[model samples]
Target: MTDNRQSLADLASLTNQPAPAAPAAQSLPTSEGDIAAPVSNEPVREPMPLREQILDKQGRAYATGRRKDAVARVWVKPGTGKITINGRDQEVYFARPTLRLVINQVFGITEREGQYDVVCTVKGGGLSGQAGAVKHGISQALTRFEPVLRASVKAAGFLTRDSRVVERKKYGKAKARRSFQFSKR
Candidate 1:
Protein backbone atom coordinates (compact mmCIF):
# COMPACT_ATOMS: atom_id res chain seq x y z
CA MET A 1 0.00 0.00 0.00
CA THR A 2 1.28 3.47 -0.88
CA ASP A 3 1.12 6.29 1.69
CA ASN A 4 -1.17 9.09 0.40
CA ARG A 5 -0.35 11.74 3.03
CA GLN A 6 2.50 14.17 2.26
CA SER A 7 4.51 16.29 4.77
CA LEU A 8 4.36 20.13 4.53
CA ALA A 9 7.95 20.24 3.22
CA ASP A 10 7.17 17.55 0.60
CA LEU A 11 4.05 19.53 -0.48
CA ALA A 12 6.10 22.77 -0.71
CA SER A 13 8.77 21.00 -2.77
CA LEU A 14 6.17 19.45 -5.05
CA THR A 15 4.55 22.86 -5.57
CA ASN A 16 8.00 24.46 -6.17
CA GLN A 17 7.16 27.14 -3.54
CA PRO A 18 9.15 28.42 -0.53
CA ALA A 19 7.95 27.54 2.97
CA PRO A 20 6.30 30.32 4.94
CA ALA A 21 8.58 32.22 7.32
CA ALA A 22 7.97 31.76 11.05
CA PRO A 23 6.78 34.73 13.07
CA ALA A 24 9.56 36.80 14.70
CA ALA A 25 10.25 35.91 18.33
CA GLN A 26 9.35 38.45 21.01
CA SER A 27 12.42 40.38 22.31
CA LEU A 28 13.44 39.59 25.89
CA PRO A 29 14.20 42.16 28.62
CA THR A 30 17.47 44.07 28.23
CA SER A 31 20.22 44.49 30.82
CA GLU A 32 18.48 47.66 32.01
CA GLY A 33 15.38 45.51 32.92
CA ASP A 34 13.19 47.20 30.30
CA ILE A 35 10.85 44.57 28.90
CA ALA A 36 10.17 45.08 25.19
CA ALA A 37 6.57 44.69 24.13
CA PRO A 38 5.78 42.55 21.10
CA VAL A 39 5.66 44.72 18.01
CA SER A 40 2.51 44.33 15.91
CA ASN A 41 2.82 43.98 12.14
CA GLU A 42 -0.46 45.79 11.56
CA PRO A 43 -0.39 49.19 9.91
CA VAL A 44 -1.07 52.26 12.05
CA ARG A 45 -4.61 53.60 11.77
CA GLU A 46 -5.27 57.19 10.67
CA PRO A 47 -7.16 59.55 12.97
CA MET A 48 -10.77 60.28 12.01
CA PRO A 49 -11.52 63.58 10.28
CA LEU A 50 -12.99 66.25 12.53
CA ARG A 51 -16.64 67.21 12.13
CA GLU A 52 -17.52 70.40 10.22
CA GLN A 53 -19.67 73.26 11.49
CA ILE A 54 -23.27 73.33 10.27
CA LEU A 55 -25.21 76.59 10.17
CA ASP A 56 -28.17 78.22 8.48
CA LYS A 57 -28.39 81.45 6.49
CA GLN A 58 -29.15 83.23 9.74
CA GLY A 59 -25.99 81.72 11.26
CA ARG A 60 -27.93 79.50 13.60
CA ALA A 61 -27.28 75.81 14.23
CA TYR A 62 -30.39 73.70 14.45
CA ALA A 63 -30.87 70.27 16.01
CA THR A 64 -33.68 68.05 17.24
CA GLY A 65 -33.67 65.98 20.40
CA ARG A 66 -36.00 63.36 21.79
CA ARG A 67 -36.37 61.90 25.29
CA LYS A 68 -39.07 59.50 26.30
CA ASP A 69 -42.13 60.77 24.37
CA ALA A 70 -40.89 64.38 24.25
CA VAL A 71 -39.31 66.02 21.21
CA ALA A 72 -37.50 69.34 21.14
CA ARG A 73 -36.38 71.45 18.18
CA VAL A 74 -33.55 73.82 19.09
CA TRP A 75 -31.72 76.64 17.38
CA VAL A 76 -28.43 77.99 18.70
CA LYS A 77 -26.66 81.24 17.85
CA PRO A 78 -23.88 83.47 19.18
CA GLY A 79 -25.45 85.76 21.80
CA THR A 80 -25.96 86.16 25.51
CA GLY A 81 -27.14 82.89 27.07
CA LYS A 82 -30.85 83.49 26.77
CA ILE A 83 -32.93 80.35 26.35
CA THR A 84 -36.43 80.68 24.98
CA ILE A 85 -38.79 77.73 24.91
CA ASN A 86 -42.25 77.77 23.41
CA GLY A 87 -42.19 81.57 23.25
CA ARG A 88 -41.35 81.72 26.96
CA ASP A 89 -38.05 82.24 28.72
CA GLN A 90 -36.39 79.21 30.30
CA GLU A 91 -36.97 80.62 33.78
CA VAL A 92 -40.67 80.91 33.02
CA TYR A 93 -41.08 77.60 31.21
CA PHE A 94 -38.94 75.48 33.53
CA ALA A 95 -39.85 76.82 36.98
CA ARG A 96 -38.02 74.18 38.97
CA PRO A 97 -34.33 74.81 39.68
CA THR A 98 -33.55 71.14 38.95
CA LEU A 99 -35.23 71.36 35.54
CA ARG A 100 -33.22 74.48 34.73
CA LEU A 101 -30.04 72.77 35.89
CA VAL A 102 -30.81 69.78 33.67
CA ILE A 103 -31.25 72.04 30.66
CA ASN A 104 -27.94 73.81 31.31
CA GLN A 105 -25.88 70.67 32.03
CA VAL A 106 -24.49 70.45 28.46
CA PHE A 107 -23.26 74.05 28.60
CA GLY A 108 -21.66 73.42 32.00
CA ILE A 109 -19.82 70.34 30.75
CA THR A 110 -18.54 72.10 27.61
CA GLU A 111 -17.77 75.28 29.59
CA ARG A 112 -19.62 77.27 26.93
CA GLU A 113 -22.25 78.78 29.16
CA GLY A 114 -23.40 82.32 28.34
CA GLN A 115 -21.73 82.13 24.94
CA TYR A 116 -24.68 80.89 22.92
CA ASP A 117 -28.37 81.69 22.88
CA VAL A 118 -30.87 78.85 22.63
CA VAL A 119 -34.40 78.85 21.27
CA CYS A 120 -36.38 75.63 21.46
CA THR A 121 -39.86 74.25 21.23
CA VAL A 122 -40.66 71.09 23.13
CA LYS A 123 -43.75 68.92 22.85
CA GLY A 124 -45.12 65.71 24.39
CA GLY A 125 -43.93 63.88 27.53
CA GLY A 126 -43.75 65.42 31.03
CA LEU A 127 -41.72 68.40 32.26
CA SER A 128 -38.74 66.25 33.20
CA GLY A 129 -38.70 64.57 29.82
CA GLN A 130 -39.08 67.91 28.10
CA ALA A 131 -36.12 69.29 30.06
CA GLY A 132 -33.97 66.30 29.04
CA ALA A 133 -35.03 66.72 25.42
CA VAL A 134 -34.06 70.41 25.50
CA LYS A 135 -30.70 69.57 27.05
CA HIS A 136 -30.05 67.01 24.32
CA GLY A 137 -31.08 69.50 21.66
CA ILE A 138 -28.74 72.13 23.06
CA SER A 139 -25.84 69.69 23.11
CA GLN A 140 -26.44 68.78 19.46
CA ALA A 141 -26.80 72.42 18.41
CA LEU A 142 -23.61 73.39 20.24
CA THR A 143 -21.69 70.64 18.47
CA ARG A 144 -23.05 71.80 15.13
CA PHE A 145 -22.04 75.37 15.92
CA GLU A 146 -18.50 74.45 17.00
CA PRO A 147 -17.18 71.17 15.62
CA VAL A 148 -14.02 71.41 17.73
CA LEU A 149 -16.06 70.88 20.92
CA ARG A 150 -17.32 67.54 19.58
CA ALA A 151 -14.53 65.52 21.20
CA SER A 152 -14.99 67.05 24.66
CA VAL A 153 -18.79 66.92 24.48
CA LYS A 154 -18.70 63.36 23.20
CA ALA A 155 -16.27 62.39 25.94
CA ALA A 156 -18.71 63.89 28.46
CA GLY A 157 -21.40 61.65 26.85
CA PHE A 158 -23.85 64.44 25.86
CA LEU A 159 -23.72 63.45 22.19
CA THR A 160 -25.53 60.16 22.84
CA ARG A 161 -29.34 60.26 22.96
CA ASP A 162 -31.03 58.87 26.03
CA SER A 163 -32.86 55.69 24.96
CA ARG A 164 -34.61 54.82 28.20
CA VAL A 165 -38.39 54.97 27.92
CA VAL A 166 -41.50 53.92 29.78
CA GLU A 167 -42.18 50.22 29.46
CA ARG A 168 -45.43 49.03 27.93
CA LYS A 169 -48.17 47.58 30.10
CA LYS A 170 -48.85 43.87 29.71
CA TYR A 171 -52.47 42.72 29.27
CA GLY A 172 -52.61 40.71 32.50
CA LYS A 173 -50.41 43.06 34.60
CA ALA A 174 -51.44 46.25 36.36
CA LYS A 175 -48.17 47.90 35.31
CA ALA A 176 -45.23 46.97 33.08
CA ARG A 177 -43.97 44.16 35.31
CA ARG A 178 -46.25 44.41 38.36
CA SER A 179 -48.89 41.73 38.60
CA PHE A 180 -52.52 42.39 39.52
CA GLN A 181 -53.47 41.90 43.16
CA PHE A 182 -53.47 38.24 44.13
CA SER A 183 -56.62 37.19 46.00
CA LYS A 184 -57.74 34.06 47.88
CA ARG A 185 -61.40 33.14 47.52
Candidate 2:
Protein backbone atom coordinates (compact mmCIF):
# COMPACT_ATOMS: atom_id res chain seq x y z
CA MET A 1 0.00 0.00 0.00
CA THR A 2 2.83 2.40 0.80
CA ASP A 3 4.65 1.49 -2.43
CA ASN A 4 1.45 2.06 -4.29
CA ARG A 5 1.05 5.44 -2.55
CA GLN A 6 4.67 6.40 -3.34
CA SER A 7 4.28 5.41 -6.99
CA LEU A 8 1.01 7.34 -7.21
CA ALA A 9 2.67 10.44 -5.70
CA ASP A 10 5.58 10.09 -8.18
CA LEU A 11 3.14 9.81 -11.08
CA ALA A 12 1.17 12.81 -9.75
CA SER A 13 4.36 14.85 -9.44
CA LEU A 14 5.48 13.91 -12.97
CA THR A 15 2.09 14.36 -14.65
CA ASN A 16 0.72 17.10 -12.34
CA GLN A 17 -2.17 14.79 -11.49
CA PRO A 18 -3.12 11.13 -11.19
CA ALA A 19 -1.63 9.41 -14.25
CA PRO A 20 -4.46 8.21 -16.49
CA ALA A 21 -3.89 5.02 -18.40
CA ALA A 22 -3.25 5.49 -22.11
CA PRO A 23 -5.84 4.20 -24.59
CA ALA A 24 -5.20 0.72 -25.99
CA ALA A 25 -3.47 0.76 -29.39
CA GLN A 26 -5.77 -0.10 -32.30
CA SER A 27 -4.78 -3.43 -33.74
CA LEU A 28 -4.86 -3.88 -37.51
CA PRO A 29 -4.56 -7.02 -39.63
CA THR A 30 -0.97 -7.36 -40.92
CA SER A 31 -2.26 -9.01 -44.10
CA GLU A 32 -1.29 -7.51 -47.50
CA GLY A 33 -4.94 -6.97 -48.56
CA ASP A 34 -5.42 -4.49 -45.65
CA ILE A 35 -2.77 -2.07 -46.89
CA ALA A 36 -4.01 1.03 -48.73
CA ALA A 37 -2.79 1.64 -52.28
CA PRO A 38 -1.05 4.90 -53.27
CA VAL A 39 -2.99 7.33 -55.39
CA SER A 40 -1.55 8.87 -58.62
CA ASN A 41 -0.49 12.52 -58.43
CA GLU A 42 -1.42 13.37 -62.02
CA PRO A 43 -4.47 15.61 -62.40
CA VAL A 44 -7.28 14.68 -64.79
CA ARG A 45 -7.72 17.03 -67.73
CA GLU A 46 -10.51 17.15 -70.33
CA PRO A 47 -9.93 18.09 -73.96
CA MET A 48 -11.06 21.66 -74.77
CA PRO A 49 -11.69 21.58 -78.50
CA LEU A 50 -14.29 24.35 -78.32
CA ARG A 51 -11.78 26.60 -76.62
CA GLU A 52 -9.41 26.12 -79.54
CA GLN A 53 -12.20 27.17 -81.87
CA ILE A 54 -12.88 30.24 -79.72
CA LEU A 55 -9.26 31.32 -79.84
CA ASP A 56 -8.78 30.51 -83.51
CA LYS A 57 -12.00 32.22 -84.64
CA GLN A 58 -11.11 35.71 -83.34
CA GLY A 59 -7.29 35.51 -83.12
CA ARG A 60 -6.86 39.28 -83.15
CA ALA A 61 -9.40 41.25 -81.20
CA TYR A 62 -8.72 40.65 -77.52
CA ALA A 63 -11.07 42.51 -75.21
CA THR A 64 -11.92 42.74 -71.53
CA GLY A 65 -15.39 43.79 -70.41
CA ARG A 66 -17.02 44.37 -67.04
CA ARG A 67 -20.32 45.88 -65.96
CA LYS A 68 -22.38 46.37 -62.75
CA ASP A 69 -21.57 42.81 -61.69
CA ALA A 70 -20.62 41.01 -64.84
CA VAL A 71 -17.41 40.78 -66.85
CA ALA A 72 -16.79 39.26 -70.26
CA ARG A 73 -14.15 39.18 -72.99
CA VAL A 74 -14.51 39.45 -76.76
CA TRP A 75 -12.11 38.89 -79.61
CA VAL A 76 -12.23 40.32 -83.12
CA LYS A 77 -10.09 39.78 -86.20
CA PRO A 78 -9.85 41.45 -89.60
CA GLY A 79 -10.18 39.01 -92.44
CA THR A 80 -11.84 38.82 -95.88
CA GLY A 81 -14.15 41.60 -94.58
CA LYS A 82 -16.93 39.44 -93.35
CA ILE A 83 -18.51 40.10 -89.90
CA THR A 84 -19.87 37.15 -88.02
CA ILE A 85 -20.53 36.17 -84.39
CA ASN A 86 -20.56 32.47 -83.42
CA GLY A 87 -20.67 31.65 -87.15
CA ARG A 88 -23.86 33.73 -87.66
CA ASP A 89 -24.08 37.27 -89.01
CA GLN A 90 -23.49 40.02 -86.42
CA GLU A 91 -26.80 41.66 -87.33
CA VAL A 92 -28.65 38.44 -86.58
CA TYR A 93 -26.68 37.61 -83.38
CA PHE A 94 -26.97 41.10 -81.87
CA ALA A 95 -30.39 42.37 -82.91
CA ARG A 96 -30.19 45.61 -80.96
CA PRO A 97 -29.63 48.54 -83.33
CA THR A 98 -28.17 50.59 -80.52
CA LEU A 99 -25.65 47.86 -79.85
CA ARG A 100 -24.69 47.66 -83.51
CA LEU A 101 -24.35 51.44 -83.68
CA VAL A 102 -22.20 51.40 -80.59
CA ILE A 103 -19.98 48.81 -82.21
CA ASN A 104 -19.63 50.61 -85.56
CA GLN A 105 -19.65 54.24 -84.43
CA VAL A 106 -17.41 53.80 -81.44
CA PHE A 107 -15.00 51.30 -83.01
CA GLY A 108 -14.65 53.40 -86.24
CA ILE A 109 -15.00 50.42 -88.57
CA THR A 110 -18.15 51.47 -90.46
CA GLU A 111 -16.80 51.00 -93.94
CA ARG A 112 -17.72 47.77 -95.66
CA GLU A 113 -14.32 47.73 -97.30
CA GLY A 114 -12.57 47.54 -93.93
CA GLN A 115 -14.28 44.51 -92.46
CA TYR A 116 -13.88 43.38 -88.86
CA ASP A 117 -14.63 39.81 -87.91
CA VAL A 118 -15.50 39.05 -84.29
CA VAL A 119 -15.20 35.95 -82.13
CA CYS A 120 -16.54 36.84 -78.73
CA THR A 121 -17.01 34.49 -75.76
CA VAL A 122 -18.59 36.04 -72.71
CA LYS A 123 -19.27 34.41 -69.38
CA GLY A 124 -21.20 35.73 -66.38
CA GLY A 125 -24.15 38.23 -66.30
CA GLY A 126 -26.88 38.55 -68.96
CA LEU A 127 -27.75 40.33 -72.26
CA SER A 128 -26.22 43.58 -71.06
CA GLY A 129 -23.15 41.61 -70.10
CA GLN A 130 -22.93 40.24 -73.64
CA ALA A 131 -23.23 43.75 -75.04
CA GLY A 132 -20.53 45.07 -72.77
CA ALA A 133 -18.38 42.14 -73.87
CA VAL A 134 -18.90 43.07 -77.52
CA LYS A 135 -18.07 46.71 -76.76
CA HIS A 136 -14.89 45.72 -75.02
CA GLY A 137 -14.07 43.39 -77.90
CA ILE A 138 -14.56 46.18 -80.41
CA SER A 139 -12.43 48.51 -78.35
CA GLN A 140 -9.67 45.93 -78.30
CA ALA A 141 -10.09 45.45 -82.03
CA LEU A 142 -9.69 49.19 -82.58
CA THR A 143 -6.57 49.21 -80.48
CA ARG A 144 -5.25 46.30 -82.47
CA PHE A 145 -6.21 47.96 -85.77
CA GLU A 146 -4.04 50.94 -84.97
CA PRO A 147 -2.07 51.47 -81.79
CA VAL A 148 -2.51 55.27 -82.24
CA LEU A 149 -6.32 55.04 -81.73
CA ARG A 150 -5.88 53.77 -78.17
CA ALA A 151 -5.61 57.26 -76.69
CA SER A 152 -8.72 58.48 -78.48
CA VAL A 153 -10.76 55.40 -77.56
CA LYS A 154 -9.53 55.59 -73.99
CA ALA A 155 -10.58 59.23 -73.78
CA ALA A 156 -14.05 58.40 -75.14
CA GLY A 157 -14.55 55.99 -72.16
CA PHE A 158 -15.21 53.15 -74.57
CA LEU A 159 -11.96 51.32 -73.94
CA THR A 160 -12.13 51.73 -70.19
CA ARG A 161 -14.75 49.48 -68.70
CA ASP A 162 -17.26 50.90 -66.21
CA SER A 163 -16.04 49.05 -63.12
CA ARG A 164 -18.44 50.82 -60.79
CA VAL A 165 -19.90 47.80 -59.07
CA VAL A 166 -23.01 47.97 -56.89
CA GLU A 167 -22.24 49.00 -53.35
CA ARG A 168 -23.54 46.87 -50.52
CA LYS A 169 -26.48 48.40 -48.63
CA LYS A 170 -26.44 48.58 -44.87
CA TYR A 171 -29.06 46.96 -42.66
CA GLY A 172 -32.54 48.46 -43.25
CA LYS A 173 -31.20 50.34 -46.27
CA ALA A 174 -33.40 50.82 -49.34
CA LYS A 175 -30.77 50.53 -52.05
CA ALA A 176 -27.05 50.73 -52.75
CA ARG A 177 -27.05 54.48 -53.46
CA ARG A 178 -30.37 55.26 -51.76
CA SER A 179 -31.38 55.68 -48.15
CA PHE A 180 -34.13 54.01 -46.16
CA GLN A 181 -37.72 55.29 -46.08
CA PHE A 182 -37.74 58.85 -44.73
CA SER A 183 -39.88 59.76 -41.76
CA LYS A 184 -40.09 63.31 -40.41
CA ARG A 185 -40.34 61.88 -36.90
Q: Which candidate's lDDT is highest?
A: 1
Candidate 2 lDDT score at position 134: 65
The whole-model C-alpha lDDT of candidate 1 against the native structure comes to 0.89
lDDT of 1 at 150: 88
Model 2 earns a TM-score of 0.52
Query: TM-score of the candidate numbered 1?
Result: 0.77
* All candidates: TM-score: 0.77, 0.52
Give the per-residue lDDT of model 1 (tens digit) for 23-126: 33235465666878777899999977878899999999999998999999999999999999999999999999999999999889889889999999999999
| Backbone collisions counted per model | 0, 1
Q: Local distance difference test, per candidate? A: 0.89, 0.61
- In model 1, the clashing pairs are none
All models, RMSD in angstroms: 6.9, 17.0
Q: In model 1, how large is the Cα lDDT of residue 66?
A: 88
16-126: candidate 2 lDDT, tens digit per residue: 887543322123334758754445798978753321222345367466666655555656676654556556676886798876665566546433345665666555666
